[model samples]
Target: MTAITINFNNVLKLSDDQFYQLCRDNPDVKFERNAFGELIIMSPTGGETGKCNASMTADFIIWNRQTKLGEVFDSSTCFKLPNGSDRSPDVSWIKLERWNALTSKQREKFPPIAPDFVLELMSPSDSLSETQAKMQEYMNAGVKLGWLIDRKTRRVEIYRQGQQKEVLESPTSLSGKDILPGFVLDLLFV
Candidate 1:
């Protein structure tokens, strides 16, 4: 039998809580643009984030090993900000102290929190502005650091609380001095 899709534009009628609740309740459901007033799932790499996500996951582990400060979250799991938005950063980190502050239940449920740092890697089909807006949202929600990595240009856009966006192009490495001192992201893969 053929399946029928509902219009997505009506998604805004729901509070962010409702949408995620829907996601939780129906894990098998596929949300699409204009099919329901919602942000549609665009990742087709068998994951929401793509190859860069895989690379970042490796970087996350290296950072954790060196700094011994936090844990990394995968895209399969999500970090839900307090503002009713859910974003699975390509890879994310939560400081050990703050992460340990949560109850077992809080850890199990959507974090209702933001990561200490978030990273987004550009995909061929991604909307740059939408991604930028999301990065801003992460900052507004108290994310301490963020990175927007553009592979095509071999550039990285750094986001911090007080500094204006810093663009590093054709760079040899990426750092986490203030965020995760001594951690380095070798751009050799890009």
Candidate 2:
């Protein structure tokens, strides 16, 4: 099903607590808040998409476990970005120092910080342009590196701060570059 976006600007804007409560009240629905205070209600991913997401998350988890350089989060974790948008990247990582700097309560809530690196895998129901825009938003919010992986097209769009997106065609793997240092994403399963 196509995700539904509701414009909440006409209504009294919800406070941060109210918004978080709304999410808590609906445990099954996935929700996102845009910079404009619009609410995005997304449908659950299909089986194939879930499998790919799990693979990607596993890779990040393994890398983080070995390197002990940062904290890794799956798709369920939402982050309150500086621009006042709450976003949940498919896979995200924050530097060790940055993660340690957050207060326990902030860490428990949507930790108000942009991730150092993020990944977005294209699902069948997702629109490419929308995903691209989301990646750009991440970059604008101070993400050091972001990857928009399109399994169907066998392509990847790499987003980085202070640079244009770099596209790659049908690569076997993706290097983490300077940001992830020594980390690489194997695209075979993707």
Best by TM-score: 2
Model 1: per-residue lDDT, tens digit, 21-56? Answer: 777786765332221244556444434336667877
Q: lDDT scores for all predictions?
A: 0.72, 0.90
lDDT of 1 at 116: 93
Q: Please list the Cα RMSD from the true structure of every candidate, rounded to 1 decimal place.
A: 4.9, 0.9
Which stretches of model 1 miss by more than 4 angstroms?
A: 1-21, 25-37, 46-49
TM-score, every prediction: 0.80, 0.97
Model 2, residue 112: C-alpha shift (Å): 0.2
Residue-level lDDT of model 2, residues 68-162, one tens digit each, is 99999999888999999899999999999999999999999889999999999888888898889889899999999999999889999999899
Pick the lDDT winner.
Answer: 2
Q: How far in Å is the alpha carbon of 67 misplaced in model 1?
A: 3.1
